[model samples]
Target chain A: MSLPHAILTALLEKPSSGLELTRRFDRSIGYFWSATHQQIYRELGKLEQAGHIRALPAPTPARGQKKEYEVLPAGRAELTEWVARSEDPKPLRSALLLRMRAAAVVGAPGMREELRRHLDLHRRQLEEYRAIEVRDFPPARRESEPDRLRHLVLRGGIDLERFWVEWLTQALGELER
Target chain B: MSLPHAILTALLEKPSSGLELTRRFDRSIGYFWSATHQQIYRELGKLEQAGHIRALPAPTPARGQKKEYEVLPAGRAELTEWVARSEDPKPLRSALLLRMRAAAVVGAPGMREELRRHLDLHRRQLEEYRAIEVRDFPPARRESEPDRLRHLVLRGGIDLERFWVEWLTQALGELER
Candidate 1:
């Protein structure tokens, strides 16, 4: 449900060929709503068939040329409706946490190392988000309404990673004790 | 994979009939790794077939009598191995955040109300976690090793809910501006 809206948003930001959309997902939108290239391509076809988007005319019209797609008015309307829809926050589902609880019953010899590995991963992710903030949303820049919302989304990623980093550190300390 | 392991851990805590197991899942394990009653029952059957767990013999064999299950040595061994297994942290997949990003592209007239609603929900969840912390893991209790590990798991839930409360509050503030 969210993937189609995610694709529509990306298309609205900038019309792109399927390959370009996949690249953008790998870079930006994927941070929040991840989709594989195959999923993206399949969704692209669905959106086209739904008349939510259309392939733009290629200047050269060459065979095997990449087809760029732009969101139709219907797509924008649907995205707007989706944005305002009321949905419950999804419950937490973490295998690591579940494993930790399982370790309480069965002694986990390598569990500490696993926690350390996750701590490192989250720390690196936090640093990456911080770098993006510095590069893209410096305090000096006057942001538009959309920029503000986009920055808020990035902050969500940054804060979530930070939470994991801190929690893992605390868990490691408890394990060591 | 995790569901089966989750069931093993719960059974190890205490041998229980399927009905009791479902209740426990709804109260405690559901916080992290949620499963429907049907899924829990299905997994229980599979575990019994796998010989990782067995139903205790009833004093009187009666039709529709409840069957209690306990983890066998093999199940304990499997759970031990699983706890020590290396698993990558699952990447975050938040539909709410994705919707916010979509809102950035399309004018979201009711988006602020949605953010506020989420903020309220998260705040309530955080409070619930805190109440559980006070009731279950008081400071003066001299916890056993298993208790310590269990408390750590509870802390993970508490911290995670706290993260959502703070992040959602921040998001709502941004939306206000």
Candidate 2:
């Protein structure tokens, strides 16, 4: 449902092919939403069939042929309608916690090790986020309005990672004791 | 894959009826993973049939017949093996960011409103997290080494929410200008 909107949004930012969209998704919006190459290609076909976007005829210099897409007026209208009307909270599905809950049956020791691993992963993520902040925003602009918002989202990611690390440490300690 | 483990873990915490497991999931593990009552019941049946969990005779209850579940030795072994394995990184799937990217098409005005609404929701989440911190951990304990991990996780949630609010304000300003 929202996939069309996501596709349209990506196209709106700039005309792109299914391959390009997948790449862009990884680099930019990938920070928030992700789609597999298969999913992206499938959605692109649907959007084109629906007349939301059209593939522009173009040739690549050295790479395989890439189809460029631009949102049609209809696509723009549909995206607007979706933005205005869609209110359902997107459900989140996580397998990690499921594994943790299941681990409780096996015993506490294994669960502690799993959590320690999770903590390490999160700590690394926080470091990556901090690096993005430093590289993406200039020093003076870091405090500026627009940069602040960008920084804030990155901060959110960092904070969540930090929290996970903290929770793992505490929970692991309790389990050990 | 993790479903079997989660059920075992819940049972380890305490023996529970299928209905009780559903409720416990809503309160604790639901924060990270979610499952419906139907899924819980179905999983329990599978586990019982597979010899991973044993269902005790139904007890006469005030409202209905309750079937309690206890983990079998095999289940414990399976869960331990699972814990030792590494989990793949789950893909991000945030509707908010998808909407924000789409906002690039609707021009600035409508997008600003959406961003503002998101910011408000995050603010409420921040407040909820802060309440959890105060209610769940004592100040002194929060500062301790073990507790510090849990504290960091909570701080992450807080910081993330705060970052969203700040980003909303600045992004809105940028759109206005």
Candidate 3:
């Protein structure tokens, strides 16, 4: 459900073909939200059926060809309504935490390695986010509304990666002790 | 599923009936992992069927009668295996982030208020986590292996709440300008 809205927002930002959306998702939206190509294609079909989006005119509309989509007025209205609605924060569901709980019962053999892998992954993600910050926002630049909102979301990812990297290091240190 | 493993770990800590498990989930386990009562009941049944756990014999064998369960050795082994298994970190998927993305397209009318609500919720959650830390893990005390692991998981919850609280405060300040 949110995927459609996410797609709608992405399309609103700039109309793109299915392939283009997938590429954008891989780079930007994929940071916060993720979906497989199959999932994206499926949602696009549903959105088009629901009249929230439609394929822009193309000369050769055939299989494997580009199919650009733009959010309809109805989609914009829906997104605005969703933006104003209050939603509860989802419960934190970390598989790592569950593993930690299980590790308590089963003895933490090989747990340190898993933590290390997570630490490395987070470190890489942090680097990617920082690179984006440097490239997109840069220093000493006036930010537009869209830029500010985008940066706010980016800030969350950066902070989250920081939390994981820091926590994992401490956890590894705890293991050593 | 991780929920079943989480259940096995909790039951390893203390034998509990379905109702007790639900309460525990609501309080502690629910912090990092959550489940509906129906989901709990279903998992309990499956775990019992799979020989990971069994009901403690009770005098009254009536419907709705409390049927306490305890983890078997098989369950412990399964949990240990799960702890050692390497899982890719779950992608970050905050509906608030999604809404924030959507807001960029449609003006942010009620975003500040939503952020305030989230701020309060995270603050309360942090208080609860800290209270647990005080009650369960007082200072200058040697923690058992299990206690340490549990505390590490709790530490994650505390830090995450702190992140949200700080980030939301900063985000609100950004909105003012």
Which ranges in model 1 have alpha carbons more than 4 Å from their true place? Answer: A58-65, B58-65
Model 3 regions more than 4 Å off = A140-142
Q: How does each model score on TM-score?
A: 0.94, 0.73, 0.97
- Model 3 residue pairs with clashes: none
Question: What C-alpha lDDT do the candidate models reach, one value each?
Answer: 0.88, 0.70, 0.88
Using lDDT as the measure, name the better of candidate 1 and candidate 2.
Answer: 1
Q: Rank the candidates by lDDT, best first.
A: 3, 1, 2
Q: Per-residue lDDT for A45-135 in model 3, tens only?
A: 9999999898999999999998899989988898898898988988988889888888877899899999999999999999999998998
Error of 2 at A49 (Å): 1.7
lDDT string for model 2 (B90-173, tens) is 656767656655654574335666666776777777788788888877677765443554454455446556666676676566
Worst 10 residues of 2 chain A by lDDT: A100-109
- Could you list the iRMS of every candidate? 1.0, 4.8, 1.0
* lDDT for position A140 in model 2: 79
- What docking grade applies to model 2? acceptable
lDDT of 1 by residue, B1-177 (tens): 799999999999999988898899888988899888889889999999999999899898686788899999999988999999999887788998898888777865798888788878878877888888888888755267677888888888887777777887887777777
